[model samples]
Target: MGLENVWVATLTDGLIRADYIAGIETHQTPALTGKPSRWLLDVTLTVSAGSGTKDSWEVSHLHRTLAQTDVYPAQAAEELARRLHRLRRDGAAGVLRTYVRYEELSFEFSYFDAGEAAE
Candidate 1:
């Protein structure tokens, strides 16, 4: 099995926007690392202020889904809060959306005929 994809989306006013597809790297086979490649859904926001041209605003959301590493929900939540706080400090008010998508897909099986094993 493999982690199919990673998706980032926009959300505002209690509404979900279209998803943004993030490029992902897949392993030909699952590894024994004990971590399932998946994204943990998390969102964060940050705000900041400065003088002159240095003044800027930024909004950020933590994306855990589609990750090559496995993460617990608590850890993911912590990351989201941390990132969001940073973003909130870095920028102004803006609706930032962070999400994950699980698609319903089917798979096929294959078989082959071969001679009996030798002792």
Candidate 2:
């Protein structure tokens, strides 16, 4: 964990920011504040499970051109996929699945809604 180690999660209003930062060098630090409430899921998950259960996740979300192609609309991607299906029914989703493939020690984080699903 030493390639100038960086597994950062410094989001503001989208949660996950209680001074929680991994190895420094926060991508040229200049964010002086916080204001994010939605624009959910720019995710990329890949895990080809062997013992089964994860159902082999293969999600993708990347857009760096065409003005970011509407920047992930569609009701915030179905409300972040219904808050990731309520964190897979409150079992604490296995930290959002990842296999042994380390693409630069891949990192991304967010799941801030343990409410609004009581019906």
Candidate 3:
């Protein structure tokens, strides 16, 4: 079986934008153990500031073999939205960095700010 999901968000007149996707592939063999009937989760996140502009900067995360079950993709997407909301509420000042760590997997990303030197 194969499954894929995606999400996108735009806020503040396109100043902040994000894209997220999660997928699952079943019936795969493990490279290390050579075990069959293994499942794989692929997750990706792309966030941008000043989207479509010259000064825009983006951050992205990609993870393979994220989970044995397919449920994590949806949960992870929700978590990401929650975190982004919290950051906006707390005045993120442009999402300089972001990260997520759950169970045995972790994702980290950094955004490049063209305006950083001015501050």
TM-score of every candidate: 0.25, 0.20, 0.27
Q: Return the candidate ranking by TM-score, descending.
A: 3, 1, 2
Identify the runs in model 3 with alpha carbons over 4 angstroms from their true place: 1-16, 19-71, 96-119
Q: Model 1: how far is 67 from its true place, Å? A: 16
Worst 10 residues of 1 by lDDT: 104-113
Predicted structure 1, TM vs. truth: 0.25
lDDT of 3 by residue, 1-119 (tens): 11111112222122223323333222344446554343333334342223345677654454333344322334444555454455445443333222223422233323344543311
Best by lDDT: 3
Clash count, predicted structure 1:
21
The window of 10 residues in a row where model 3 has the poorest summed lDDT is 1-10
Per-residue lDDT, model 1, residue 46, is 27
Runs off by more than 4 Å, candidate 2: 1-72, 88-90, 97-119
Candidate 1 or 2, higher TM-score? 1
Alpha-carbon deviation at 118 in model 1, angstroms:
62
lDDT-wise, the better of 1 and 2 is 1
Clashes of 3: 0
